[model samples]
Target: MTPAHHQARTDGPPHAPELRAAARRLGRRRFLTVTGAAAALAFSVNLPAAGTASAAELDAARLTDDPFTLGVASGDPQPGSVLLWTRLAPVPYQADSGLPAKRIDVSWELALDERFRRVVRRGRATAHPEFHHTVHVEVDHLAPGHVYHYRFRAGRYVSPTGRTRTAPAPHSRASELTFGVVSCQRYDQGHYTAYRHLAQEDVDVVLHLGDYLYEYAVNSSAGSRAYPEGTLPDLFDRETVTLEDYRLRYALYKSDPDLRAAHAAHPFVVTWDDHETENNYAGQTPENSVPPEEFLIRRAAAYRAYWENMPLRRPQLPDGADLRLYRRLHWGRLAQFDVLDTRQYRSNQAYGDGWQFPGPESEDPGRTMTGDAQERWLINGWHRSDALWNVVPQQVTFSQRFNSTSTPSKVSMDSWDGYPASRERMLAGAQAAGVENLMVLTGDVHVHYGFDIKRDFDDPGSRTLGTEIVTTSVTSGRDGSAKPANWETLMAANPHLRFYSGLRGYTTVSLGRELARADFKTVSHVTTEGAPLTTAASFVTEVGEQGLKPA
Candidate 1:
């Protein structure tokens, strides 16, 4: 799992830094002339020559006509800028996107009004064929704490208008910030009913902890009851492994009108878990026995597609397959999010996978979940952060989840319980740094869990270090039951667990200087469309309180 043993992928096309830079540097006057001509030249080279093509050939007009099929998304918001993203996939969910292999000019504009009458900034960027014709414009020099409307334009195609807002100024004493938390959106399991409601909420940002997409084959049968029968196409019935495969999978998920609407409505802070690459993959190791070399190649493809689709800034751009996804985003002085990449830098699951009693191997101090470098990075970030609330948005459960109440307690190997020493270090470091309001937002269990993180889980009266809020999946478990068979046993097994829910939905949090409140929103049904959302439970953590209290 260490970097020294793994060789980076050097087989992809060279980086087009010059084209990207030139596109960004074009003035308004030059943009009209140079970009138009560049678009024509790209068409000539990529598209079939006029009067010299078959009737079945892709229509060049289609590229310009409704090119923004996947929808627009904004992410990684800062004080002065936000990243805008869109892919020119007129014919999404197919190989090559039914377009030519040439770079196209994509124009974008930011306006102060929803009507776009008060335009503030306008620019053009190249949608490189190598990047699957995806455009990521890092719009900067914007007014802080201002809401802006944005859209993309190609030939005759105009994208849907998207709303985005910059963070408050760094020194501003922002009183409150609201955001929604979601994860584990398995397409076949259920519809994106949660996102439909999330889009309607009044929130600043949406934190997607992980499991954005599942890497499993669709199974719509009686015994298992995967996706509703014939919900997904036959092409996506198999698992995604290649770059093209991953790209198509994204198209499939993005094609959902509800999901697309959510992305277009608000900004998102996204990270991936095991399902994005492979089921329960840990570092360079795949869930099953696959060679390290082959697994790395697969990882590279998955990471590349992830960056292309997400609204990430240039620094997070993929270097082959080694993407720097673990970065921080600050909401002025109110809150600072230290996004973690737990899957990419973790030791293999201890004692194989599934629930297991914690043995000596699981307690090994050398066995790390965040690896050496990332663990240091996270701890250092925590120490240096001055924000009132320090939020760690990451994958996997941060607190212990025992399977039994007996002396020989069994825990999920996939969670932090397997890496006990690493988890302890993080908790102890936060305590040492005097972090008063350390909040952990988690995903990947497909169930909602609220836990009081303690220095000693074995002792019920141990000092509480922080609180962990684990949001439920968007649709991972289909329409889950209110009380699973082992619900009571689990509730009794872990005294630290404050709340638990089996329904599918998300969590909405409102952060203030005095306290933070989390609403555990649940959808009664996700198997069919139009599920009603309700607040299953609510909790609040006061400024000086180490754990959550019923709100």
Candidate 2:
């Protein structure tokens, strides 16, 4: 939590990033009062304005009028350029009134061939309205990790032709690479059948380790059931602050055509959790932070309406309640992925009144989850990675999942089981950087683990220290919250748990230069929406032994 204790919030306006410093010492006046209580708790939480305002205000229609509506997507890429995104939705259900801002002209192409004769790179961008009209377009130079095919014409509505790839040139030696990793998605619980089997596989990228959305309360029953349209809204009134409540919650998860055909054929690498900023919020507060100054202004208006409906790449936006969102990506030399931000520079949740939850206080090694400049920018990208897989992707479950029973449980003080010496300096800085295939990729525990990690998974003398998979949930509240006598007393109290499934699904990996496979992929249920993936489980690590075996 430093960057001079960070900044960003600027009235109804900016909404997040003031983080101040009460989290005491490493010192300067406890860093400026933890920075002015994070910027008066991120401009007192008024977070509204993310979408839904054009039922009658637009004016950009000359090139035609197909208005995408949350389709046509792509991400990061680099080598010549690749970002492209779209949102439009003109009047598909009303929100500021779609199709006006220069009537939507948004062409983008790239073929050499997903079958377009052979063209190479093309561009055009504009959806306007300061950004609610969404359309990103990064697309540069071209020719790196190959495989391409894209589409998104507007005025006559086209989209759906997407399959992209490009990353290999930083020294190139690639062999194999496949990817996928998802997280919490709660459109009234169920049916993205793990994004319709990640839009029929052949993966290239889709990490997204976050809650995507679930502020709760449309008949909120939680953890086990309710909201099959019993007229939905209440895990606290599905908690949003507005922009027609974050554009009707991203137009009900972009009207799931299997999460828009896995965001129009692959390429997604997001990061945002605590339901994108609220529950158990720390660096800025709100899950249950005793009115910690209006839950840091309702988490800087729910993280600037989740950086205005993600597909990011505008240098990850949100300047005023501050948002950098840890990043780094590459896949061609067989993987590099980083992406962290453990709930925006954390610190709070080291519990009290008799040691109960959230921790680090046995003596704060500078209370952080990933802040000492993001753990020295992830130990300097694991001492400048060489890649045959590095992949951290992150959100939670960085291996220490406590509750070793002191009884009367509520949950570990707040997970790396509450910072056991910053998870032993990030697993002894990836085992003093000889870092082999160190794969982490997790999602907030909606049950599905795998583990093997050990600086001491409760010491039988500790060593292993590498693999973890986690993943589960397109619907929250882990399917079956343990209890078959606490799953045999947590498998005789954690023997580096190898598997646990409640199942909703997502996780597919491949990496390979020797081995780096994972395939939990379950999902014949989530009550309803799209459901069908099922590989159940598989694991593997090999390539100079980094851990997890079971294949």
Candidate 3:
């Protein structure tokens, strides 16, 4: 199968000057406050009024099927709070999610024990049809670095119990932190066997770097999994372009039992790549023939659906066509995770966004991967971080990836290799901030990669500034091989690259005070079900010393 990144064949012009100006203007505090409040108000209108005399409510006793088919999830954990999520979709994939056009009361509970003998927090949230009947409850006043069991209930229906954990106290010294990194799970391409295995791992949280659900059409037979005829609805037989289209697409993907199992197993911290909206889009610029104005509409729909479906707080909600997703999460004093959004605030790809030789245009200093505001934010975060490890969880490769051994090496325009100036600024910022243990976690390419982030890729003996671990896709490229076609060439051209593997799986990283160990896990196949998972490779980097060493 062709790599998903190769699918972006540029056939449209760059973003208009006015749109760029608008994006820049969005940085102003006044504009953001106005637009954000307006958007929130528009969304709030659908919610039932507090202390209303007579408001419509869904009768849980009248339901026949399970409303929690998509399962329960929790995310964005804090020392005192965690966001709980569940959508009441008895019959998922429907336009209204098999619910009437009204508000439904969903009660949720958090307990110290799995059996609910020690109930801690309980409250009710209104699931509005305007928001696809999804409930996002932000539970606060919880203990730090503690495990909790949570579930939701609507009428007589009860959701599956989900496990969640809060971050350690701000200044506490955490001994260790372990998380699973995963991305690029295309429902049509293969089965979600990776998620099934991930649910069993002893991970505290799961970081979804991007491409949670592809926008491609899924056949009625459901592509590689080959479900029985009529299993999937006809609504999913086309690309997602509208609000309803995106909503149904998510319903279809989340309906999978394995995917739901993973959500119920651990909390997820998510960020989107280009596929969440379109392939290789830059800022407001699209990849194909769609007009910029029309494309923004589609983008708005995609962003809204993404926020509604994920276990995110209200602050991350979208405002028209824009959503602020880049934020920081702290795991006590052990590590600080700066999750980034690369696709939203990036310059158009150099050389039409394809694999090409470097040039002045590609090396332009003005072109940015993370827009100016985000760049400053990241650098500032690093400067103020007091954790033992400063971890950057992002969507694309941070190190240079040479495709061939030729003099003029061809690199992916979609990655950091395309914007050398941007990469330079990032490295320089980290150095200036005196970051000791900088670890970048990436997921986009269908293959796993371990790179020693060098101060200068042109010089093999240059100082190893940091380490980057790229996880393989969940199931994007179908069943992959141990060595892809470019594996040897990449290894030969870039000595900084230490490990490479082509397989379907995720990566687990255990961060301690002195050492951070990364285990590259893989599965033999994904086109068919029941693929056994195994460890493909393991590498570790010391706290003060950078660079990967085989473990």
The number of the candidate with the highest TM-score is: 3
Q: lDDT (CA) for every model shown?
A: 0.82, 0.66, 0.87
Better of 1 and 3 by TM-score: 3
Residue lDDT tens for model 3, 140-219: 88899899999998888899999999999997999998999999999988999999999999999999999999999998
RMSD of 2: 21.3
Lowest summed lDDT over 10 consecutive residues: which window, candidate 3? 1-10
Model 1 spans > 4 angstroms off? 1-64, 219-233
lDDT of 1 by residue, 1-551 (tens): 01122232223332235334545687545543443343223212222222332113233345645788899999988999988999988788567886787667778999998889999999987776667888889898998998899999888788999999999988688899999999999887788889999999999999999888877776433113344676555777778988788988888889888888888889999999888899999986788876444566677778878988888887776654467789988888889899999998899999997899899999999999998888888889888888999999999999988877787888999899999999999988888788888899999988889999888988889988778999999998888977777789889999999999899999999999999999999999888788898999999988887788999
For candidate 2, give the lDDT of residue 519. Answer: 87
How accurate locally is residue 56 in candidate 1, as Cα lDDT from 0 to 100? 34
Which candidate has the highest lDDT of all? Answer: 3
RMSD of 3: 7.1
Sorted by lDDT (best first), the order is 3, 1, 2
State every prediction's TM-score relative to the real structure. Answer: 0.88, 0.34, 0.92
